[model samples]
Each structure stands twice: as C-alpha cells, then as structure tokens.
Target: MSDKSDERKRAARDRLEQQRELDRARERRRRTLIVATAVVGVLALAAVVGLIAANAGKDDHDSQAGPVATPSGATGKDGLTLQVGADDAPSTLTVWEDFRCPVCAQFEDAFRDTIAELADSGQIKVDYHLATIIDGNLGGSGSLRAANAAACAQDAGEFAAYHDVLYRNQPAESDDSFADNSRLIELAGSVDGLDTPAFRNCVEDGTYDSWVEKSNTAFGEGGFQGTPTALLNGESIFPKKGDEEISVAHLKKWVAEANKGRKPATAGATPSP
Candidate 1:
C-alpha cells in the first residue's frame, strides 16, 4: 500500500514537471518571435528612411545655378512668351516650361546649346512660354512667382540670361524654395544688371502675377500633357503616353531634318498673338 501511494505521488509530480517544461518551451518561442519581429520592423523602417533621404535631393545641387544664355532675338510679347532665333526660319520650336520643373531642367541641359545653335543660325525659331502648372500640381506659388520674376527680367531685356539662371538654380520639384521671393531676387544676381532695385521691387511686388495666371490658363487650354512639352511647327512632338522616346540628339536631328524640307512661312505670319 505504501509503495502504491509513493508511485501515485511520483506520477503526479512527473506530469506537473512535464507541464512546466511545455510552458517554458512556449515562453521561449514567444520571446524569440517577438525579438525577430521587432528586428524586422526596425530594418524595414530604416530602409524606408534611407530611400527618402537619398532621393530628396533629386536634381538641383547646393551650388547657385548658372545658365548658358542663348539669344535668338525673337520676341518678348505679352510678358509671357520669349521668342528667339530668326523670324524667317523655316522650323518653329515652341516650348512650355516651368522654373521648378526638373524634367524641364533636363531638357534645358540637353537642348539649350542645340536650340541656341539652330536659332542663332536662323535654322529654327524658338518660342518659350512660361507656365505655372507645377505650382498647380505641387500646391506652391513658386511657379507663379518665378514666372513673374522672369517677366521682370524681360523689362531689363535680360530674359534669356535670367531664364537660364532660374533653371540653373531651380530647386527640386518637391522643394518649394523657389516660392520664397527673396531667393528669386538672389537668383537674379546671376544675371548682370538683373539684381537691381527695380528687379528687386518687381519680384517683391509680384508684378506679373496676373500674366502668370493668364499663361497657366493658356497652358491648361492648349491641350498639352505635361511640362517640357514641345511643338515643332505647330505639331505635337510630346504626345501623352506611348509616344516615341525622345532624347537630345533625337531632338536636334528632328530639327535638322525638318528644316531640310520645311517651307519658310510668309512674312507677318500670324505674329504669336
């Protein structure tokens, strides 16, 4: 009887021990899982932060921008469009751009010299229309202010110089640094005689704000897709999606080839009204 009792107690104690072992194993698994999950979350967060940091400074460098000014001596009509190249050129290149646009800056980088060459040589006439679609798209006033400031430069007859300067110093599309009017004035310093008091007051006063609005309206109504849109001889070269890929050399070749067979427009041909 005593042996039987002893055996019963031992069995109970053994079962309890087994249960405790099971509990301990489960606890270990829980802790390990928690640690692993925490580590994965930390890694994921770190990766996201790194990505954002890397791309924030997209195109614009920290240095003040400088533009290679190309003068076609075309037109500065309505304080909006600045025309360059010879009026009698057979090919007409019309461009719509914004100061805060990175892609437009890319186009400027690749084609500025080429455009200058064609316009200067009277191979093509280039018309530049400043648009503030970026301001509308990005929810900032930089586009408007920058366009106005460019217009201010027009009065000084340094539109080409300041235009180049603005693109040179254009901030990233996400950065609204161009919205600060002071920076606009500071950028004016890049152009000779463009940083004067009149230019300063003009930028501060937002003198051409109305014209910027008008230009934006024209851009919206012009049936265009996006910034850096270019039209050659009143034909769309930048169709929305699925259009042929475009590059600097492609553009230059397009112009050169087009000029070969282009018929010169009659004098007084619908002056950019």
Candidate 2:
C-alpha cells in the first residue's frame, strides 16, 4: 500500500476509538442518574413510613381512656365552683390545677374514679381552683384561654363537663399544644348541656377574665407554686411521683383517718386535718 493510504487507514482507526470512548461516557452517566434516582426514592419512602408510624403512636396515646365523669354542684371559696361531685357531700377535696401542666392530667386520671365513687355515695365534695401558673409568650395564651373558658363554663353551669373534656384532651407540654380560645369553645361544645353561644360569647368578650384572675390570685395566696396540688379537707396533700399508679391505698387510709373525728352530715363545716 502507498504511504498516504496507510496514514488514511490509521486516521480512520483513531476516529473509531474516539466514538467508542464517547459511547462509554454516555452509558456511565445514564447509570449514575438511575442510581441517584433510586436512592432519592428510597429516602422519600422511608420518610413517609416514619411519619405514619409516628402518627400512629400519637393516636394510641390520645385514645387510651374513656371520658371521666364530672361531679355535680361542687363549690369553692369566692363562688368559683365546679360540678365535680355530689351536692350534699360531707367533705371537700380541693384541687389546684394549671391548664398547661401534664402532671395534673395524670393526677386527674388517677383520682377521677375515687372522686366519682365518693361523689356518687354523697360522701365527699370536690372543688377545683383552676390556676394559670404556666406563663410566658410561647404558649401562655393557651393556658390563659383554657382557664378563661373553664370559668365561662362554670358561669354557664356546665363546668364539670367542660372540665372533664379539658383534662381528656389536654395537649402535651408545648406551646403548640396549649388550647386556644377557639379550641376551648370547640371542646366546650362536646359537653352535654353546655350553652355554646353563651360560652363562646363569654370567652370571646373576656367575661371570664375576672374569674380566672381570681383563681390565679387564690392560688398565689393559697401558696400553690406548682400544678397537681391537692388539699384534702384544707390540708395539703403532697403526692409523690408515680403516686397515681400505686398511691390510692395511701389516699384511702388518709381519708379513713380524716373521717374518724367528723360527723358525716356536717363534715364540710370542719377544716381538714
């Protein structure tokens, strides 16, 4: 072959090699895109599954128990009362509670049955002083809103039912979980005999603000610094942690001892020991 022909053949071979390299590069890019897409899809799916599981857990926590019964015609100092137990009960059990406190919820769940039993037997009266001790800008508004709504419910003669719902649907200890005024009205609607319009108006117009302030002041005067504070017959009851689960026996003993010196029909007149 002539020299020029040989050179032409070499050039053709070089061109072929360059085309092959280009083809390989394109294939690598396509494979890389496929792998990246698969990784992204897997991450998204995992995130969705995690979210579902988290939601399920929260639901389980929220739906754990049935609604507790509220007592009737339970009264307190300053006419700030709740319909928690029997009207003619011999003794009074006063509870100081903060709307935003979780321990109060636990205490409610633990003692609700006992309160119901005593109230039903006409043996005891329970009074709740709803206080707003949780303050600050984050979600303090919710605590204020709920306390005000509770006072409004009391004004409308549906305090017990509304109180039960508040404890039942109490939010976790967070700003977002605090009950707003709108949410308070919404919850009040679930009570059997609650006057929705009156309750809403009272809440909206801040008619119950004075009552809430009174309760808060009472709490301060009563020396209640934290939530879930209880006074049996006016004597402070200091509940230990985990007391809700295993402390009923102790409470019963205390009640028995407390009732020994008093006459059944005239017990409320006597101060608790």
Number of the predicted model whose TM-score against the real structure is largest:
1
lDDT of 2 by residue, 219-263 (tens): 788766588887777776757422443377766666667777654
How many backbone clashes can be found in candidate 2? 4
- Ten-residue region with minimum lDDT total, candidate 2: 264-273
Let me know the TM-score candidate 1 reaches against the reference structure: 0.64
Residue range 94-150, candidate 1, lDDT tens digits: 999988889999888877887777776667777888888888888989998898888
Off by over 4 Å in 2: 1-76, 81-83, 86-88, 136-139, 176-179, 240-246, 261-273
Per-candidate TM-scores read 0.64, 0.62
Model 2 local distance difference test score: 0.70
True lDDT of residue 254, candidate 2: 64
